[model samples]
Target: MSRLLHAELTKFRTVRGLVLGTVATAALIVGLGLFVAANSVSVCSKGTVDVECPTPPAGPGGESVRDKFYFVHKPLPGDGTITVRVTSMTGIITYPPPNHDTIVPGLVPWAKAGIIAKRGTTEGSGYVALMTTAEHGVRLQHDFVHDVAGLPGAVSTGAPRWLRLTRVGGTLTGEESADGVTWTRVGTATLTGPVEIGLFVTSPSDLTVHNGVGGGTAQARLSTTTATFDNLGLTGAVPGGGWLRDDVGADPEPDGPVHHPGSAEESAGVWTVSGNGDIAPLAGEGPGTQMTLLGLVIGLIVVIVVAVQFITAELRLGLVGVTALTAPGRARILLAKAAVLGAAMFAAGTAAAAFVVPVAERVLHANGSRRPFLPVPDVVTLSLTVGLLTAGVALLALGLGALVRRSLPAAGLAVAVVVLPYLAAVVGGLPAGASQWLLRVTPAAAFAVQQTEPAYAHVIANYVPMAGYFPLPAWGGLAVLAGYATLTLVLAGVRLRRADL
Candidate 1:
């Protein structure tokens, strides 16, 4: 066994394709890794530019609030109650767009009508102008909004204006007040979970808020608009339970304090708030660090092709008969080839993973995404998995070669079995479960290890038919592929024992 294994290893080392494939795999992994690392460093250094940058709010633990100075004409939704306090009295806060044909054009789909406050208006409009039921959608029926009494009129700019949102049961209560201490209820409304709350500003008539360029032109047509916000807050019935706050101040010098009327404020749009609910755990970093274990399977297939060539090329030259006569044990020769192929595959897989895993992690991190660093356990599992897959493909190739005793036919059969199922899965749109199962039975399934995401899991659960469901858990998927390889090897071993050299 030792002598046979040594001879097989010696033959494998001499193969040109095997040597070249190893070199190419290493180069690809390293080059990609460096690129990803450089990008990640650039992303991290951008500081304030990162959307996910941590910015804690001022004051102690209190209601988290986001302030947007300039809001476009769009509705805002919330899981709880919401209030809209207008600081500017000159802008038009209308329910129906000026035109009936087009809904607020360019608005995000999630936008919903809430409250509108115009400037320079009194009696019907004041410090707080409430959005009527006709304006708000059906979801806000249970929620309430209130207009404050003795509210001020519109002005160029001075102090900030504020609105408060408080959720009770399944209802929201909106309140407005001249000062944060005294408040009046607006109206009530309801909203869905993980609700979104934010402000929007639109041009009463294409007026720029900063320079006040268009304000004079649309002055006669402009409605009452008020602007002054301070002490913005949010709260719920539960004690010490609400979304966290992160306060962002006015954009500093250089650019100056220029405000666009119909544009979302840099500090406002789409703020993620954690209310009285659980935050989902971040996904495990390691498993998603690199390509799936399946990538190694492809490398194994290449090794197996080489193994098949090693075996059948000799057979085509009538060397197998010569080898068998000298060795006298066909089983030993078959075992030697299998051992050689498995070792080559294991080495190649380890090297490829060493190169690929780090690069993958860098790419994810550069994008402000987290992933696991390659660890010893993952390496071991991947190496074992690749070894098993390659051995199976190699054994099958050897058996086919022995049966056909011709290099071309055996090579073609090996490639077909290893490559055809993957092509079918891609082109046929087979259900993931069926595809995975078919892949498990074929050499292609070994590539499943390369998947870090729940690609197959999502496919099986969401797309596959109920009766066809055969979803394998991540580790289980690897096992299933490994099992196929083992089975092929066992069958090939049996064939080798019986076939004539």
Candidate 2:
């Protein structure tokens, strides 16, 4: 077996064209990665002058987040509790779908109105809120990423919801009640020091989805929500001043009003609060590791061709027969060939991915791409993922070559099953569901392992393949591709044992 392996390695080395092809493939990976970074430019303007966009704030978990809402708050020096009964929630969707001409009274699913005990009035501060959502019922959210579901219903005048948030030392507890009598603890968060306790309201942009040439498109229109809160109660040490109103994250307009402004008012022991924008983890597209790894798609095609030809070249030259006679164990010979090819591709792929990722990231930032709010995969993880992906594709190609006993057909089959499906899902005109289906079932699913952005149910956006989301988890998708490769190799082994050489 060792001799057979050595002999196969020798054959691979002696072929100058094949060796050069591998080198060229690695070069292509790096070249295309840098090219993508170079071309990805984000430009912002203020009036007629160009301006650099401000970096987004980091949440408690260091993930990028959107923290904008209307707060009617008072400073509490220490431990405190704030409670409010939310009687009604209403919103307007501007220029919705179909005609896109008029604003309608409605609410986007994530519209939230609640009582919060935050570290301060600052955006992105650690806070916990027991809130009622437009569609998701009662929820307990903290720090941006963490969310827990509470009761299951919307708020109305007849069916009001009671929300309470309390802080004792470092622990914060959230509770909700339908009748303000029996309180159900929703969740807890850890935050200490002085905080601002208040009533707050916020709504995300109204998304209008449309099917288009490339899967679909989502247009975000400005939207706002108003919440009517009565029976407001507070506990613990508080300042003597009246409630302060601040529209966190809202920019001042030319006319001095808040841009996409939020409002706060008190009348006869009742508070009406209205706000625009979201107070959650940032969703949708951002600069991702995928930007650096774009070259892998083209590089994978080059690898498929090289891997297919590795075996097919031997078959074409009538050398496989001579080698089979010497080895006697046909399956062992095929396995040995696969091991050699897979190892070589793995090394090249890992090196290329590792080198390009950081380099491309610097380039991307220089070109004004937004810093990724999602967790970026580390260099080692990215390298190993790409390495494993390359090895899997190479083995599959080799198996197909062995089964078909021809070069072009086997290479074509490998690319059709893997590369085409990937390209189609990411860039083709297929519907979002169809794109997700392809990524789930096809060998192209392995590409999901490269994905850095994950879908969050709490943050609604286009979770489509084109928007850098996959239906399957990263390793799960890789397993799908690995399963196909393993099965194909098994069949090829069976064929090699029975077929005429």
Candidate 3:
């Protein structure tokens, strides 16, 4: 096996074209990425030109802070408790332009509807809530920006769900229940707010991208969400007070110009608030949230093309037979090739990512936005993720090359299998579900491993490719790609062993 590995490495090293292609892929990863950043500086330079752009620091995943929600509250300078029964919550899903059609399943997984006690109506105000989410069941969230998952249970329309938030001086405890009788403590936070208490419902305005022959923009289809609250019990704050309403994060005179449109209504013993925007730390799309990955997309294309040709070239040139003759076992030859190519791509990917990501961040900061709010570890993790993703893509391409058994056609098919799906997700302007579906099922899903943005349930943004929102978590998405590569490689090996050489 060692001799076979050595012989295969030698064969690869002797191929000047393959070696150069690998180098070029790496170079393009860094070079094209930097170029895209430079271009973004020029275009998004007309970016968020606001003095308040830098404050409220970026989210943990490098997203701009936003706090947009409808509020119905009267000031509580001291301790208080707010409870409400969320009777039902529902909304609609819409597609992008040309034909804007409303669809069902209006609720995305993390949409929130329930009761909140906030410092004030302004965004970034400290707050806490016991709410029924669209899919996460129940949760306790505070700071108007953070989430705390509740006990394992389901909460939905026609489901009897109740939430309670009690403030004891600075300590706040959130509790939830199914029957409004037995309370289960979800989580707690410490806050001293001139608390505003009321019912709130907000959606992330989930985006479905559409890509055509020309450039594409993401269309955010917002569900006109409605959440019913009954048995409204509030202590320490006067009841029947007029609710001073405003879109907390949507500044009419924004830090820049972001739409902050929301309304609250009280009727028939239930208080309902419908919010179209989000309730997050920041108001609108700032420089930190805006990202351009055209170069990386191109780099993905180049990398996969080269990786496919790496193996298909051997088969095309009849050199695979020579390898079989020398290695004694076809599996050993294939394994060695995979290892060699994987290493090469990994090294190149790491170098390119480390340099390009920092450059992109710095360029954006220099162009008028603040730097990405990523810790050193997160940045390093992102770089490593990209490096590992390149390795994964290389392996995927190699497997496809082996399956097709021809250089050009294999490379083309490789692009269709991995790169095309990825391209569609990024710019295809397809429904959010469709785009995410492609990423989840295709080897290209591995690219999601590089996402540094976190999708906060309350924060409203495009939540699409432009904002770096992928459906699956980073490692989980990589596993999907790895699974594809593994399945295909196993099949290819079986074919190599049985087929006529």
Candidate 4:
């Protein structure tokens, strides 16, 4: 078996066309990665001057995050409890379609008005909140990405919601209530240190989703929310100071004021806070690792050709019968061929992905793109996933070659099953649901392995194929491709052993 494997490897390296095709796969990945990175540019006007857009802040878990809101807070030198009753939540949405000329009172479903205990006033600081959203009822959110559902109802003047956040040592507990007396523990988070505990309000941009061809499209309009909080209460080692207001993470406008600045007002112990932005994982709207790996589709096509040739070329030359006599077990021969091709493809794909990931990120950053902060380990994981994806596709193609016993048809079938579905999902103008369905059941599902940003139910964004969110998790999607490959290879093995060459 080892000798057979070695023979297959030797044959693989000896074929100039096969060797060149393998190299071309890597070349295409890197080439397209560089192209996309170099072309990406982001600029914003600060007053009359155009400058590069600021990068999003990294959260405690190291993911890029949007953490901006209006806070009416005071320093809590020790563990403390802050409570507030959100009497009303309202918002303004500017220029939403059709007429595109109106500033109207509304709330983008996720708009939040809450009480929070935060490590500091900085963007992306560790925090916990018991918040009432416009449509999602009460929620306990912590560390920018974690969200726990509490009471399920909208907040209004008539039906006010009471929120409480308490810090006990490193643990923060969130609770919610309707009448401010019967509190239900909403959730908890662990974040130690002195914090800013206060009343806060925020609203993310209103998104108008369009069910367009090739997945859904969305447009974001500037929006802000105002929440009226009465019956504010504080307990536990509170310092003597007035409430301070800040628009955390707001970008500076060109007119010298903070862009979309949030404001807070207090009158007769009641506070009205208005703010724009979100405290959530920034996804779908930025240049990500997926963009750098976009070349994989083209690379996969090259791999299909090479992988198919690995098996079908021998059959085409009528050399399989001679090889079968040497190996004796035809299935073993097929296994040897697959092992050699899969390994080579894995090595090439991994190396290309590893090179392109960091290099393309730097290129994108240099070109002023909104580059998300991905940890080194996560980057390595992505590269490896790409490698595995490449290997899976190659194996699938090799099996198809064996099954079809022809080159063109096998390569075409591999692409039809893998690459074409991916194109339809990402570029074919398929509806978002149809695109997600295509990605889930097809070998194209493996592309999910490259998605760096995860779709969060809490974050309001276009979570679709074109936006790089997959219905399946990374390894799960790869496993789907692997399952297809394994089944195809099993059928191919049986054919090889039973059929007369």
Candidate 5:
């Protein structure tokens, strides 16, 4: 078997197109990765400018940007209400583009700052809030996902925005007032567990961009909202004199004033409120991988062409029968063919990723974007994923060549089975709903292994089906591809051994 494998490897290495194709695949991977990195740019919340420097968003489970803020509260494990008046709400929406972080003066119209009745300080918890927007007036939001609009105009210090939240078992109600009396119902929400009722203030701390790959992002720079709760009021299960203060998911900058976002002036009738965090989602409208899809699609095409030609050329010249006899076992010849193709593809893919992932962050940085870093271990895992995806597809193609013994039919079937579904799901280039089930059942599931940013129920990223995002996890998706290759290769071996063609 070793000698047979060696012979197959020798044949593949001697083929100039196969060797050149490997080089071309590597070139495309690195070249395209560099292209995306070079073209992309980012603005930091602080004054830092780097190319796509992904602000390691504080959401622990990647649900929403629920980290970095202040929470002053008393535990109300059951039904409760917390009411307060918001005097004046103001903030700075900063845009620190690649070169410099420019503070944008004041909050945008939709910027929210107000009172919250949360499930807890931990991210992804169920909760609701009655907040004042910069322009849209009062709003009600729940679970970091649901948003309901209220009174449609900015409230002033003189108008006096009165906010209230009342909990009834699983249901919570939000209300707003003008003169600390006539409270108007804003909206309501439902939470299933223990609740934390408190005075909370938060800001956008990150950008929510959508135009394109490097669109103009108006990221939040700073938000220091100072509101006085004069006619102090807490109804139902109020625990006085023991209020816990937390930074939520963020703490004060090491050198900033006020620890835990202004937590030093909580007197009998005073609470200086400020928050530097985003209760929002990350924008993943485009590809986040370091050009893997760009490289994989083209590489698969080139390798498929080479693989089909490699086997069919032998069939055309009547070398298949001769090689079967020479190799002693007909299945051995098929195995050697697959071994050769798989090995070559694996080498090509690994080489490409080695060059692509290492310098990815640096490339983005050179281009003045916030670059996300991948550790060496992660880089190696990603490299292995690339290699495995290429190798599995190669073996599948080789099996198709053996099954059909014709170049075009083998190539077409191989691509339709392994690559077409991927393109369909990724770009909707094919018919609608065609790729969903195809990816689920076909070898194209392997593409899921390349997915870095997964869709979250709470995070509102562009979880578009046409965006090439597969619904399977990395290894699970790769297993589907491997299963197809193994089954086809086994059938190909049996056909070669028993059928005289």
Candidate 6:
């Protein structure tokens, strides 16, 4: 067994394709590492905040502070009044609403509106303020619930119970509780410098007018209720953890001039950036970014090409018969060859991935926007998954090659196995029953391993409509692909054992 393993390894190294594949893999991994390291911002100095820390580069918004940290400010529930005041180093009160008619007076122009209002019949309103000598812009937003359905005939039950302010380097989270002792985390905002923050409120639901009328209908009147805020407090920035900050200036204003429409920067925050800007283009169209359907097409082509090379080159040269005679056991020779082919296919597939992924990313970045790319785990897992699937599919091709002892029919069958189900899925769509289960057995199922989005799960689930169809969980999708691979290899093994190759 050791000798066979050593021989197998030797064969792999001697193969020119295998050697090139290994080099390609190493180059990709190193290139990605360097790219990330060059682009990442270093936050921690001496394991703590450096009071004399040098200013970071201008962020997307051309702001000096490029990140933000947040801490929570808890306000009590129910109808109440609260006033928060912020005083700057220059004696300017930067923390309040812009004016009395507005929510508060003298608050930072860009600061987000942070308030924790209760649901039910009451109404709430508040304002926050910040002061900075540095030309910094603030953004205020109401943190609302996501993805929850409201009751029938009721307006959206979603309420902003938390507030988050974000800047380049820091963040703050505020939660309101009935008793301030125990507070729920409502939301958090990031900040970059020393700024005064305050919470202030006015008005309850009682004063709200429905459509500017006293005798408005009940449905219209429901919009009149508002909650007043009270008991505003401020806490110092917490250590280490902070809000994810982006280049505020780089972000396009909703009504502002258009820059790079649908650029890569727009997609930056969607994933976590790694060491630097080395990104993978999993979402775009390229050889690497081609849809799963395309991958299936490519995989089929690979199997046919390998099968043709194996059958014609070795059989026409009479090597198969000689090897079978020397081994006496046809099964052992076939198994040895299968093992060699599997290793070669795996190395080739991995090499192809390494070669294609980085180039694809660069192309996408160039065509789109410039932003940091998120890191995916090393190619080890991706390589293994693809290798296993390819090996299984290859074995079936090898078996067909042996059974037909001809290149043309085997290639045609291999292509059909990969192409037919995809064609069926496209034309008929995955039917709502056992037919969908049949779809999973196709090569497309294996490609689901490459998906990086949760939404793709829904797409895949809908693609295959079965009675018990829930889109396979990430791991489940991989397993389904593996199961198909295993079945193909098993059938190939059975054929190899019986056939007189």
Q: Which candidate number would show the highest lDDT if scored against the true structure?
A: 4
Tell me the tens digit of each residue's lDDT in model 5 across 295-342: 667778777778888777887787777866657786888888887888
State the lDDT of candidate 1 residue by residue for 286-400, as single tens digits.
2343332224434544554565676777766766556677676776787777677666655655666655565556565656653334455665565455445555555666666
Task: Rank by lDDT, highest first.
Answer: 4, 2, 3, 5, 1, 6
lDDT tens digits, residues 134-218, model 2?
9999999888888899979999999999988888888889999888899999989887888888999999998866656665678
Q: What is the overall TM-score of model 1 with all chains considered together? A: 0.46
lDDT of 4: 0.87
Better of 1 and 4 by lDDT: 4
Each prediction's Cα lDDT score?
0.42, 0.85, 0.70, 0.87, 0.69, 0.36
Question: In candidate 3, which residue ranges exceed 4 Å CA deviation?
Answer: 42-63, 68-125, 130-140, 145-164, 174-188, 192-278, 281-293, 316-318, 321-326, 429-433, 456-461, 499-501
lDDT by residue (tens digit), candidate 4, 68-99: 88888888878778888889988899998887
Off-target runs (Cα >4 Å) in candidate 1 are: 15-278, 281-301, 367-380, 383-392, 423-437, 453-470, 490-501
- Candidate 6 residue 55 Cα shift, in angstroms, is 22
Clashes of each: 53, 0, 19, 5, 18, 45
List the pairs of residues colliding in candidate 2.
Answer: none
Q: Which 10 consecutive residues of model 2 have the lowest summed lDDT?
A: 369-378
Which ten residues in a row are the worst by lDDT in model 1?
272-281
Q: Give the alpha carbon lDDT tens digit for every residue of 1-501 in model 6.
A: 444445545654676654554444334433543343334333323333332233333322222222221112233222222222112211112122224232322221112222222221111111222211111212122211111111111111132132223223344433333233443433443333343332321111111112212112111000011112223333334223332222221223345653221111113212111110100111111112222113334444655556445544555666756655645545565566667766666665565554444444554344342323324453445555555556555666666676666778877876676556544443343344434454466554554444333232101112221111224443565566556545655565566567564
Ranking by TM-score: 2, 4, 3, 5, 1, 6
> Which ten contiguous residues of candidate 4 have the minimum total lDDT?
208-217
Off by over 4 Å in 4: 211-216
Q: What TM-score does model 5 achieve against the real structure?
A: 0.60
